[model samples]
Target chain A: MTELKLDQALIKKVISATQNGLPICERPYQRIAEQLGIGEDELIELMQKMLSAGLIRRVGLVPNHYALGYRFNLMTVWDVADQSILALGEKVGQLDFVSHCYQRPRQEPDWHYNLFAMVHGRDEQEVEQQVAQIKQLLGDACRAMTQLNSLKILKKTGLRIRS
Target chain B: MKLSEQDRQLLNRVQQDFPLHPEPFKVLSDQLGVPEQEILDRLRSLEQQNAISRFGAVFNHHRAGASTLAALAIPEHEIEEVAAFVSSFAEVNHNYQREHEFNLWFVVNATDQKGVEKVLNQISATYEYPLLDLPMVKGYHIDLGFPLW
Candidate 1:
């Protein structure tokens, strides 16, 4: 699809309208459109434009991984040689068990990790095994690694924008 | 919670994509070979069971607005007070106390980069702790759904 200029006003309205999940009904889109004071086709067209513009990632069911029994979700950070980060990051991202992977900036002295990957598993052993695979992939390039296990959740409301 | 084979299939299907049609659930019903009413019922039940947290659009925060992953090192005794203060901001979402020296980690999101910086600066000034602000340099993956067997 060709790149299209997004209408910010319409996009904001659509996001504010659907941020709290779509209504579970036969004509969900139509209902949302009606509430937003637009026709169903117009609403869908705006959504399509946003999706094409990479504003909306996906429209789907977001599962609660922890509630689904994948109890251990660890943010595994690795400090690998700068030269090999791009290659190693690609390999680590392809792992079925690694849901999110990115190369973030490193805070020197205090933080040396540049590669971050999120590993999910049913138990500690499973998470450890997954982390081991990443370690093995990095091999000599990986100088240090740490698993940040969440001890407590202080807040967890997903992304929101003021209407 | 024990998941039936059908439940697993439904979960796997919906996570990948949801149709953007007048009757979106009905499209899913056709694809999954389950009746429309039954699919709706299953989704409602799964949400009630907390298996499905949300069933809608997942916006790309970086594209829609601005955000960054930030962490602060809070003294053990003062974690509670520090966390409460940090969580008071509407822009601070997904705050957690992790097992690390940089214990208190959270995501700050706002409509623009200036808004995000204002929140972070305010929080930093409020507390006299070391704050590490890390933003994404590159992303290797996007919209990859988890597969449940």
Candidate 2:
């Protein structure tokens, strides 16, 4: 596992500057480098290092799923056997329809679900069909599951670095 | 939003693995066989149309700071009030009202574990209901860039 020294002042400055999104220009990197008072090559090298270190996931367009016709976004929660979760979670995540899958801490008594899978679809029927497929895949290992459909988006913003 | 065939091609091509060259748009133009200006224009138009939320580096929240998915079961009558109160905090970036018992859900992110805890503690103290804090143990399918067409 490669550890990134995110605490470095240069790295923090770069993250803060480019986190909102890069400038749209013919020489975007150069423009950013100029703004940071660093040479373009040096800026690019630091960015490449960050990308390699897994600090920056990618440098690309982030499409709005809703605008792209994926209207229904459901966060499906599952309570699978603790012993089988790792294997089952991997299987669930491999499904083409499942966008995000994770094993999260489960709150006892009221919340027993440990596995969460995010499913996106164009409509209710499509989402239900996808959820059913997950249920079948889990089989008897899954005890209880529920789908939480997003009713409204209250707030959505990019990360703001507190200086 | 309706998109032309050319628009679809340009979007699908530029979604991920964008070139890091000096003239990145020119590189894309060479590969996609579209004029560099046209590609730029289309991207700008798409962004204006809300088709593209952002076009830049996407950071890994866990790598940069501490974050968690939290939920609170706010009563229907006070949903708006609670939602507004939660949204007031700078740490609460993505907040949503979901159809479940734990209706009010949001993601809290901060520079460190203590910062994250501070935000969570404040929210918990304000609300009479129990807050369910679910931090990720492990994430699969983190490579996001899904096909848009």
Candidate 3:
């Protein structure tokens, strides 16, 4: 992986951009450039560089799960056999319903699940039913768990490069 | 390193909500007293520079009527095929590969219990393997936007 060497100015630009994007107008980028007193091309070039270096994961829209009515969201874990783990992950990732998927280290004796995915549903029962299908598919090798929300959301944001 | 007064004003307007109006840009232009074309140009530039990812809406799946979210582990070698297969379903949103034991993970969102079951069943029948459905019992925080800087 290539290292992202970002300077204070670039970092500040990114911060400002994310925190306060240009107003919804015809020439948002032009507005940003004027604000920073930089050429539009120069600003764009820097962003491309950052993206190539993995400093920026994606430039797209993020939908709000709750507002859209996907109230019941759960994080699912699985104990996938080593042989088929990658194929299975790829397949799951391609699913439209899945928002996030990742492999995290298991905690201890209680946590044996190595594979993890998140699912959203209308209610708990609906989520449970989905789990049942997954259980049947993985058979004995898979142990699934569903966690419910107990409190209000605290924070949800992406990485902030230090300026 | 320096920002003009107009830039500061524009940033302040969009920090929380990018307008939801039908001509959001027009609304912004009127508020900021800047030419509409200027705002549009600036947004394009900001996007090109990776300063702002994009001006888009965030959807809440659960509230939208989706009923389930789950993940499964697949062997490294078979990840490509499985991911392709799972992604084929309209209900499956997207998947991610993380560094962990159950390396392969994905999400499934359906309208209801039956919807979840149908998608899961389809995956099982196609792959001849079971899917582990770990539903979110509690959500601490799930925001995708971050401070770019």
Candidate 4:
């Protein structure tokens, strides 16, 4: 990993710039540069660096899932066989319906599933059908639990470099 | 670094809820009294500058189907490998390396509880590590998007 020296001013500017994405314009970066009193090329370079360092995840749009009509949602957990975990994950991630996938540690005594994946569908049956396909792929090495409803939805914001 | 008055207007309009109708851009353009081409051009430019990651439909899995949120503690050395492995699942939506005891966390959405359990079981057998199924008992915050200030 490359060492990054994030200065207070740069961090502040980066956070502010991201918080206020470039106005829809022909040369949005140029406008942001002007607002920050910096050269366009320089600002661009800094953003690139920030991305490379994982300071910012990505500059992208987040669609409203509810508005899109995909109302049914749940998080699934899995315990996959070690030998075929990688191959299985690769095959699963390729599906367009699956939005997010990754692994996490299991807490002792209660946790069992390890491999985690997300799937969406038009309805419960649709999602169930998708999961059935996954089960066919993984055979007996999968266990799961689903959240019938979300009790709360906390703040969803990326990391901001505080000046 | 100059913005035409139209640019400011488009930004203000696009920042809010987008129309669901076909030719939503057209509607926005007419409402904002700007050309559709201009609206699209600015949006494209904004994307190029890393202003917006992507524009598309977002899904609510529970209403649509079944899903679960899970986490596991993976060895630091195997973090990348595990992530890559988990990401391969078609049902896996988003995975992240967080700063926590259960460092390796990922979201899995499936049609039903059985489907999710099957995947987890398979992963455990394959990885030879215990998987903690930390389903979101309570979702404190679910929105993953933030407005650009």
lDDT of 3 by residue, A1-163 (tens): 4433656466456545654333445545566667777876766566555555644444334333454345676666677665665566655554434555555445455355666566666678876776665556556444454442322232233322223
Which sections of candidate 3 miss by over 4 Å?
Answer: A1-12, A19-22, A124-126, A129-151, B1-149
Best by lDDT: 1
Model 3 chain A: worst 10 consecutive residues (lDDT sum): A152-161
Error of 2 at A161 (Å): 1.9
Each model's lDDT comes to: 0.87, 0.86, 0.53, 0.56
Which stretch of 10 consecutive residues in model 4 chain A shows the poorest summed lDDT? A152-161
Q: Compared with the true structure, what per-residue lDDT tens digits does model 3 show for residues B105-149?
A: 556666456777888888877776445565543222233332211
True contacts kept of each: 0.82, 0.74, 0.07, 0.06
iRMSD, all candidates: 1.3, 1.5, 14.8, 14.3
Task: List TM-scores for all candidates, in order.
Answer: 0.96, 0.94, 0.48, 0.50
* Residue range A9-46, candidate 4, lDDT tens digits: 76556565655344544455666778788887776666
DockQ for candidate 4, please give it. Answer: 0.06
Q: Native-vs-model 2 lDDT? A: 0.86
DockQ of each candidate, alpha-carbon based: 0.79, 0.73, 0.05, 0.06
lDDT (tens digit, per residue) of candidate 2 on A1-163: 4544444688778888887888778999998888889989888888888888888888888878789788888999999999999899999998877878989998887689999999988889998999999999999999999989899999999887675
A1-163, model 1: which lDDT tens digit per residue?
Answer: 4334566787888999999888777888888999999999888888877877888888888888889898898999999899999999999988888888989899977788999999899999999999999999999999999999999989998777987
> What shift in Å separates residue B77 of candidate 2 from its native position after superposition?
1.1
Kindly report which residue pairs in candidate 1 clash with one another.
none
